[model samples]
Target: MSMSTLLAIMGLLLSAIPAATFLRNLPLFLFQPCKANHAGNVKVSVLIPARNEEESITECVESVLKSRNVEIEVVVLDDHSADATADRVAEIAASDSRVRCVNGKPLPENWNGKQYACYQLAAEAGFHWLLFLDADVRLSDTAVSNLVQRMQRTNVALLSSFPHQETGTILEKLLIPLMHYVLLGFLPFARMRMSKSPAYAAGCGQLFLTKKGDYKSAGTHEAIRSSRHDGLKLPRIYRKANLATDVIDGSDLARCRMYRSGGEVIRGLLKNATEGIASPVLIVPFSMLFIGANVVPIVALVLAIIAKSTLGIVVATAAVFVSLLPRVMAARSLKQPWIGVVLHSLSIVIFIAIQWIALAQQLIGRRTAWRGRVS
Candidate 1:
């Protein structure tokens, strides 16, 4: 094959993978309902680890308190925040008997701040099922009850939900939608459900729900105490120990604004970008796949236009469209901005840059710092 033909073939394969996977997972993303019958007897400890979430702490607590048809206790861990996170939790606790705040212990050596906070919360929790949520996450009135019901029916020891991401700023819109894109486009949820391999394990730390016994047996947050991406790591740890873990679409039940501005988005992603990959050996090829799958097709389309080759144009255009199928579906399902679907190429470019920056930081022995804490 000629050089252009070889490049076109490679682009087609890259595009085909995401297109096929997206189609395979679209049904689950669209129609797999979170309609499990209420499990009234299941008491869930809604654990919140707040470092400096004063702005959203009250809302987060109140939302959990509003949960219906399930027994729940709201426990907020104040992780030595400079803000009034603890005070807000305390205010809620005073008004509601079920809501309480616990002062987080001093960060021990070799432990991440969030993990330590989670560990303390789990210790104080007086229930069998533990629901770890970020202070920014806001749940619907039926979220807790519905989640419990799903857990009971699935019988998975550890379950997580990908909440609806609320993005405001332009940068947030461009980047946040990629979360679902990477998830549904790459992972075969059917296989992940049946497989016991750690390779297929995935979860979201923003909303992790699991039984106390399984968590303790899998070492809880302590197993991944120092790891940056607990969402990615914790599920693998459970799978490694032969425990069940899986994720579901919780967008209808909860939503969160994870990052406020461009800088926050970059820093937040930097902390866990490298950790998302299993090993350093996979980084190069993983990066290549991202570039090949999303970036190369756009380039090929331009080249075909310049070369005035009709067949090249047709192939390149189809490849580009195929690559975009997942992002378009995700944007609609997740309720992201329509403009983001139009600008998917730009998002891919920025994502690739973030991954490289994280890899570079890892290589140069630089740690990611967040909320006055470095990891």
Candidate 2:
């Protein structure tokens, strides 16, 4: 309760920032998947799964289609989308034989929808390799080639990229950069690729590339049939299966704005945060510690200053500001808005407010419907 104790806690949290970064980045060892024109006849199947992505499906499909290399097929699996997603893809397929729209089979018990959809897409694909992409992600021209080159070179069973996140909203601006900070700083990609521990696989579903045989070798979609963040787990399976692997910084080759609105961002974040290498048990403790350490000192500083406790105000303000430095550094990378810096402090406060909302949502078996499908 004393100012010194508060400052000490803030110091611990601030120190933990680097440790988190180290822990995360320690295992993400990626060498970039490369295809050096070795056996130029390599066939690639770009698999896209859509449920209700009418807003972005066409563009996503089109972007990949434009990358028509030697042997490439853009297989868009329509996962029973209620929207015109299927029709739109079908329309594109009708005109271009290379663009095929396969109907996604119904979801099986205990299987997550996207994984099942990806499985179905794989079954329909007749290529040497499979590239899984979300309907909302827009790929750069060299995205596939870049990953292909890396995969071919390293022979990784599976390779995935964490695309550069694009953010706009106040929430996205505030929390989205934390993702990259957590990823690059906490879980370095270098360590993730080298270790077989499931924790090492930190991939984004937006861009997953694997040799069709390697995918099948590692049990394919069957392994992570129930996972919500399999994107971050596939590489581990590959390593366990003895498949040589490599991943790279695909910021140049890939870009995605994961969610659309502020509410959607929060919900989507909570949906994955509980599952993404972070434990629900730690949430409350982390939040409480942050509040007690940083929030309390700052508040105490304000009150103390009003009561003429000059030393108290200076001491608390300096500790709180220094503690917030890590978050401030993280916020600068977001490039969204300046208010995000202030919101960065609110993270613990906001997280505390919605701790149960997040925990209960996952614990009570409540399903989150994101991007039009019930998750």
Candidate 3:
């Protein structure tokens, strides 16, 4: 084959891999049904680590308190917030005995702020299961009960759910849906559940559910205290300790507005993007693969039109369709904006740029600044 033909074939293969993986893992993204009622006696501590999260803390706590069919204590740890995050939690605590706010101890030299806060919350929790949640995540009335029932049914020690991300800004719309795309496209969800390898483990830190024993056995947040990507790290830690862990679609059960504006979205993602990768050695190749798989097809389509090459046009069209299949499926399944699916190429471009910026920052040994703190 000619060089141009070879490049076209390569692009087609790159796009087809993700599309095939997504099709095979379609069942994993289906909306998980909540049991009519949970009969388990498992008491859960819904732990939240808040730093300058005054706006969302109250809503997060209240939503947890709404959970039914499960005994739950909503514990919010104020990580020395500059705002009234603790006071907001305390306000809710005064009216509802199930809600309580605790002052977080200062971060030690070895610990990340959120991880240290979670460790302190775990210490204060008096429950069989520890459900560590982000302050911005809001759970439905049956979310906790459903999660517990699923855990019992699967017989897994660690379980996490990717919450439905709420996006408003253009940047948020372009980027947030990539979360589900990456999970379904890159990872084989079925293998992740069946395999015992740490390589297959993955979770969302926004809503993690684990038994107290499993948490302890896996060394909890302390094991990954220095790491920024707890979502990716915690699951590996559990698998390494011979514990079962898996993630589920929590779109119906919970939702979170991860970032408010374009600037916030960039900053929030930059902090953990580099740390999510296993090694720096894979960065260059992965970047190339990402661009080739998602971007090259679009470029080829333009070139095909210019050259009036029928074969190139057909291959480039197929490549674009395959690359977009996963994103379209994810957007529809997760109830994300359809506009994002239509502009999928723009989203991938922005995603590639973000990854490069994150890698650059990491190489320079620049500390990640988040919520008025650097780590």
Global lDDT scores for all candidate models: 0.85, 0.68, 0.85
Candidate 1: regions farther than 4 A off: 1-5, 29-37
Best by TM-score: 3
**Of candidates 2 and 1, the better by lDDT:** 1
**Which tens-of-lDDT digit does each residue in 279-374 have in candidate 3?**
377667766777788888888877776777888888888888888888888877778888888888888778878777888887888866999888
Pick the winner on TM-score between candidates 1 and 2: 1
lDDT by residue (tens digit), candidate 2, 179-245: 5544555455555555666556566667788877778888888788877777665666777787655
TM-score, candidate 1, is: 0.96
Provide TM-scores for the models. Answer: 0.96, 0.81, 0.97
Name the runs in model 2 displaced over 4 angstroms: 1-9, 19-41, 68-70, 188-190, 242-248, 277-338, 351-355, 371-375
In TM-score terms, candidate 3 sits at 0.97
In candidate 2 the C-alpha lDDT for residue 255 amounts to 71
lDDT of 2: 0.68
The per-prediction tally of clashing pairs is 0, 34, 0
Ten residues in sequence with the least summed lDDT for candidate 2: 26-35
